[model samples]
Target: MFRVLVLILAFVANPSRAAAAPPDVDLELVLAVDTSGSIDIGEARVQRLGYLETLRHPDFINAVKSGYLGRIAIGYFEWGGKVNESSVVAWQVIEDAKDAEAFAAKLEARPIATRHGTSISSAIRFGTRLIETNAYFGARRILDLSGDGFNNTGLPIAVARNDALARGIVINGLVILIRPTVSTVPLERYYAECVIGGPGSFMIPVRNVEDFASAVRQKLLLEVGGLTPSLTAQPAAMHAPVDCRVGEKYPSFVEPAFRN
Candidate 1:
């Protein structure tokens, strides 16, 4: 069944999976982490190591294999003032267990070496270019931007979102909410409304950096398998009400197998 789906998706994608551009990279997903001034070195390590740990877990491997095609392209970058931001991993195509292991190992070995302004736009643009420059076009292309602030530099988010969407890029977000008195609800909404683009885009907010693991898992599941992204971590109070308004926004990608 998975093979058939891969063939179909690959077939619809022009001559061959390798032939397509832009939305290239079978199951491409970018990890856009925050290294802005707000994040101290300890917090940055937590964020970086958190994802490296998640990728090393067996569950992430299973998630990578969840797609009919086991191939996935990934790129990592730090977002901040355009000057402070740069790519951690250029463009990596993980096609199997060894590839995933190597990529995870590399990430684990990489040190936290960025501290600058938090510009979500720079990260988004970097991810978009990574996808556009790749030879592998996956069934899914996602720019997973995790940050604690809204856009403050470079291009405005709306224009960047349009550019990404025009190229069939899905900009899912991982918004880290830490302030007790300050709710990150507005930030998450900003992501959902302005930051992310494409048919099936969503955002998840992590109230605390400690919960980053679970949030990373949830985001990974949704990104690779096309699961419905919702705030399952209910606060004593709900910020975005989960109502019967199902499939109201992201109605494009959803399936039974994807829920895995």
Candidate 2:
């Protein structure tokens, strides 16, 4: 009787520990989309559509079911500036076309929120928090951050990247380079050096808006299957190494104009 009472008291003291374990999936993916001031309305819409179509793609559904567990968990969020991260969709499992279609519908129905400034660092931290709180456990944790501009606010991105990597999160990036006129260094290079980290982390750059869909499809496959795309398949612009400090240097040229 005393042992039963002690066990009951222990369960009561730590209810979370006694709670049912989260469902296990092959991958826990957080799609952290950028809605910073630089993104603008048309570009933002393109990004949203890119994601929607990718989610609804037959190949993506196949990739989800190819795993041992035959399922993956996903969440969506938008981020910009400090304190502007918003979860667009809660964690959900994807095992078949129906689940993927439902997730796509949610994306289609979401209203976009406009925010100012770019804070990739904050987005990374937000992804980390989502991974920590999600009700599904995945063999792999991946944060897919899509952005067009450098990190201009919040903590340094390298710090956040290192922290997330330390916690076993793989950070990948979809570098939106449609506005090359606004960038001093290649956006893909920025993502490769300062943003993405962890085993098999990679960045896919899309120069033309039309390529967004295919790039996302391929990126999703690579992530879900834990397969690396051939280096030869990478865009020609990424062949040369780039300076990692380019993101840090961007504000020195752009911030003064914003202040004025």
Candidate 3:
């Protein structure tokens, strides 16, 4: 199995020995970030800061703590293509404020260059593999997808999305409309209509790059715990998780789970 170890505060708090496993969080969140060539270095910086700022935000911290077990597992990765990509942060379980900040600090310290392609399918595939490896499938599995554009390479989004849903995985979208000459609601429509899926899945578009922080805050609030969408803020219904083992898309995207 592909594995890399890092000191995680949650692991310390709930140590799992060789013969035993720790109690899992009620949710496993996979944050898939876009590092495609389309996103310039400056914009990537803005997107990167959005995550750091969210982790720094007290509201996000509270949201993490608000889970049924007062904790949630999270992993962050950057995907733009099948190769020449890297990990932003590994699978993490934030059981407390300290753990959350540790993740933020790690991201802040990493320096990134722009050379990845827009491969949303591969990103989703990576996310599913990550969650399965965490052994937190029984927990609520969420693949948090953030990107500025549509899927161009690898598998078709609907195919991957439908497969993810069939595996009881919820995929939420954070669609960023960079320097949109017109309005961003249209871009978000693409998300709601195409990219976003799974139970309670919804997309939050950052119309203005300046609004990135706010969008992240709102999305995190809803994504972590089951929070209702705000009608005042482009309200949309959330998608329900699906498992099509015996239905359409059966055995789709479920191979990674088994392989893991």
Candidate 4:
């Protein structure tokens, strides 16, 4: 009994484990993709392919190399409910074509899975935590959110968005206007006013299926280079007034998988 107690005490006293120091990079980006039930399998496939192509695209690689450090850390995650944030790919350093190809290959190996609800706020919070714990120190940390619907579960998005902004983390959006006709409030407006924040934060709405690849490439360029795309030439409605709480009007039927 004394020997067992001594062993327990030793274990408690020396509980520390060595951890690698975080490396420095130009940017740390979390690609938070939506996998809510609203997005069908076909749509999900398109999104996956779009990201894979963007990762391997020459334009994106050039943008990455344009940075002073010529490298960036990136991670891919699928978000839906408060607890349904799944990591599709871990953080990877992209310094050249070979590194980018390896990252794309990892993404392609993951099985596409969908969750039950749309929790944009949860995604933001999850992404912020990821940035905090990653093995890289980025000059600019960014959360690139891509989603079709609005927040229907988890904490309020405004709170999460504000928290992230307060930490100097930029949150951008890729508003996939998959069902513009069905939604009363234009999603682009919702994303502009409520979703995105921090310096150089902006969103590009993809209205047509064919434009996904081009828009993604452009978005990646902006993100990697820390450049804000000019929105002055866009339609007035794209910057129109919005009700951030519009999504709250819907009944909450989905329970979070993380919270029992």
Candidate 1, position 200, lDDT: 68
Q: Which should have the higher TM-score, number 3 or number 4?
A: 4
lDDT for 13 (candidate 3): 25
Candidate 3, overall lDDT? 0.68
Question: How well is each residue in 61-148 modelled by candidate 2, as lDDT tens digits?
Answer: 8888887678999999898785353446878899999999898888888887668888888888888888867777666789999888
Task: List the candidate 4 regions with Cα displacement exceeding 4 Å.
Answer: 1-23, 83-86, 181-184, 233-241, 249-260
lDDT top scorer: 4
| TM-scores vs. true structure, each candidate | 0.77, 0.80, 0.76, 0.82
Better of 2 and 3 by lDDT: 2
Candidate 4 lDDT trough over 10 residues, lowest sum? 13-22
Residue-level error in angstroms, candidate 2, position 184: 4.8
Model 1 quality (TM-score): 0.77
TM-score of model number 2: 0.80
lDDT tens per residue, model 3, 1-260: 11112123223322342125434575678888877787788888888888888888888878877765677878887877552335557767787778999988887877866665566777777777776567553246688888876666666666667667666677898887775424333556656766777656778877777887788878887877666476576567675532221112222443343333
Q: Rate the local accuracy (lDDT) of all candidates.
A: 0.67, 0.77, 0.68, 0.78
Deviation from native of the Cα of residue 89 in model 4, angstroms: 1.0
Clashes of 1: 9
Best by TM-score: 4
Tell me the spans in candidate 1 whose CA falls farther than 4 Å from its real position: 1-25, 83-87, 180-185, 230-260
